[model samples]
Target: MNPPLFDLTYCPIVPALEVIGGKWKPLVVYHIYLGAQRFGSLLRCIPTISKTMLTQQLRELERDGLLHREVFAEVPSRVEYTLTQTGLSLLPVLKAIGAWGRQLKEQQAVPELVA
Candidate 1:
């Protein structure tokens, strides 16, 4: 018998990681958690990201059905990005991760390390 073309039975988390697995994906999603924001705002919030890198991450997230981008044909070409329903579903996950990180920090040998 032939083996399955793709082996996803190992774990379900594999698929979630495929979408928001990138280093910046989760951060980008977290930024959008507040509300719709402009491209400039996203860049400002994530100062470490370059224009090119941010654009690439945004496109990837959009392609993954986690974000929605709207472009306006104004003088400056306004663009806004907002999280989709699928993306909103990650709120609880993000919150949980944040709590876990805090716990790890508090329990670490050097609690101040988290600061």
Candidate 2:
């Protein structure tokens, strides 16, 4: 019998998914690409996500180098999140996928007319 193809060390995609392949991760990435945003802004943009889930997802993205977190020390601390170079590199791919989805939706909307 052949051994399994994916040992823990063999594939990075498996681990990458752990960081950014959830229902909310892609949305977060897409929004952050538009501009740097604070946590409150992210919560507003992704209204369906619970605060706990959003915080967990952001921390995961930051740990994976897909996002950068900046903290400003002041009377009350300020923080912002922005995409890292690696994350920004994914923008074109996301845009292309979104365009394709829109085209597919348009195609599905018109009923076929019999001649």
Candidate 3:
């Protein structure tokens, strides 16, 4: 018998987008993918995102199984985020998205402003 055809029940990009397609999620994932990082570090990296919003994004990423949050017991508690295997699989896509964004930005730049 011929092998079953590839699953076509739904668009694959849909689920991928669902996982990484938010205003902040892709940024969160990309930074973590760059390296395991602490909560404060992420907040610094993505300025303009308020602490509450960053916290919300981190919680959602954890809930979606894309990030692992580890708490270190110390005089001051420290929390770090690392990507899960599933999350690792998604990072390259985020990188590509970043590249595409750069290209678009460059393309849209005013010639005078670019100087």
lDDT of each: 0.88, 0.88, 0.86
TM-score of candidate 1 relative to the true fold: 0.83
Sorted by TM-score (best first), the order is: 1, 2, 3
lDDT for residue 52 in candidate 2, whole number 0-100: 98
- Choose 1 or 3, whichever is better by TM-score: 1
lDDT (Cα, tens digit) per residue for candidate 3, span 53-96: 99998998898899999998986888899999989988777778
Q: Pick the candidate with the highest TM-score.
A: 1
lDDT of 1: 0.88
Q: What is the lDDT of residue 29 in candidate 1?
A: 94
The regions of model 3 sitting more than 4 angstroms off are 1-9, 109-115
- Residue 13 shift from truth in candidate 3, angstroms: 1.9
Off by over 4 Å in 1: 1-9, 109-115
- What's the CA error at residue 80 for candidate 2, in Å? 0.4
Tens-place lDDT digits, model 1, residues 12-114: 7888888888779889999988888898999999999999999899999999999999999999889999999999998899899889989898878564553
How far residue 69's Cα lies from its native spot in candidate 3, in Å, is 0.4
